[model samples]
Target: MGIIKLTNIRVYAYHGCLVEEGKIGSDYRVDVSVKANLQPSAGTDNLKDTVDYVHINRIVKEEMAIRSKLLEHVSKRILDRIFNEIPIAEEATVEVSKINPPIGGNVEMVTIEMTLHRHNHKQQSEL
Candidate 1:
């Protein structure tokens, strides 16, 4: 197994519980990591056989564009799409950070992280 990571994807998005936050928006940083079997691609040297980072980046950008009340909601949406769209991805973790969040205090950022495994998703569906 191997992992592909896309880090520090910056975007301007409107995602927060505050009304002012929705209108004014804020800066966000997103990171996504996906695990998959890399032996096939390593041997074949073919893009089709591996988890493509470009595809992953596209997913992050698309999901982050949507408005949500909380970072957790956006993080879950990103994970769900990764598994649904990238069939080769066995597991994925996403971190969504709100830079200079409005929670009051000297905080650098507020981040929400979520991890999902393909098997875990299957089990949830069966339930």
Candidate 2:
């Protein structure tokens, strides 16, 4: 019924397609835009009012820190952890970016963005 947006959350981790890349960790930037009803939190203004952003970052960082074979998997894991750990978030769009990839291309960073909705499909239905 509403929207909550979180942007530019960065985490340093070691996950990549190559071996050395994993050995040498890099910065991972995350931008999460979640859509849900925040009426209760808005009105209550209590600690339990809405989804805790602090805890959300912790979940994302922990999930991203895991050594995954693919950025896609990492993104999905972070997304899943957020939805599972934070019940108030109905749906979330996670953009996971790798700073200065080791590919043979001219780019400062390579980003893998994944969008996932909350369980039961009611979250995306609002959008």
Candidate 3:
């Protein structure tokens, strides 16, 4: 199986459990990985054999706007949304990180990283 990786996708939004965090928001970076067979794309030089990035961006933007109390839930929502929407993808993983969160400390950033895997018949998207 071949894999396509998308990294360092950035978004600024209101996503956090803290009151000020939600009100002010912050910068978030997301990384995603997709696993699927790339035989046709590799052989024919056609885009249809691979996943589309525009669709992925749309899903990420839509999900991030929904708001969440925790980064973990937001991360899960991203993974699930792509899995449910994209047909050719077999597995997906999402990692979300917040830079300079409103923690009032010297810490660089707080991160919520998760890797989710799905088989052909298993569909779990209810966020």
**Local distance difference test values of all predictions, in order:** 0.92, 0.79, 0.80
Per-candidate RMSD, Å: 1.0, 3.9, 2.4
Lowest-lDDT window of 10 residues in candidate 1?
118-127
Candidate 3 yields a Cα-based lDDT of 0.80
lDDT string, candidate 2, 6-107, tens digits: 788978889887889788888878887777678887898886867777887787778887888788988877777777777788788888888888888988
Better of 2 and 3 by lDDT: 3
* Residue-by-residue lDDT tens digits, candidate 3, 1-127: 7887778888888988788877888888887888878887889888877777777887777777877989898888888777777777888878788888777798777888887777632644322
On TM-score, the stronger of 2 and 3 is 3
**Highest TM-score: which candidate?**
1
**Descending-TM-score candidate ranking:** 1, 3, 2
Least accurate stretch of 10 residues (summed lDDT) in model 3?
118-127
* Root-mean-square deviation of Cα positions for candidate 1 versus the true structure, in angstroms: 1.0
Clashing pairs in 3: none
State the lDDT at 12 in candidate 2: 85
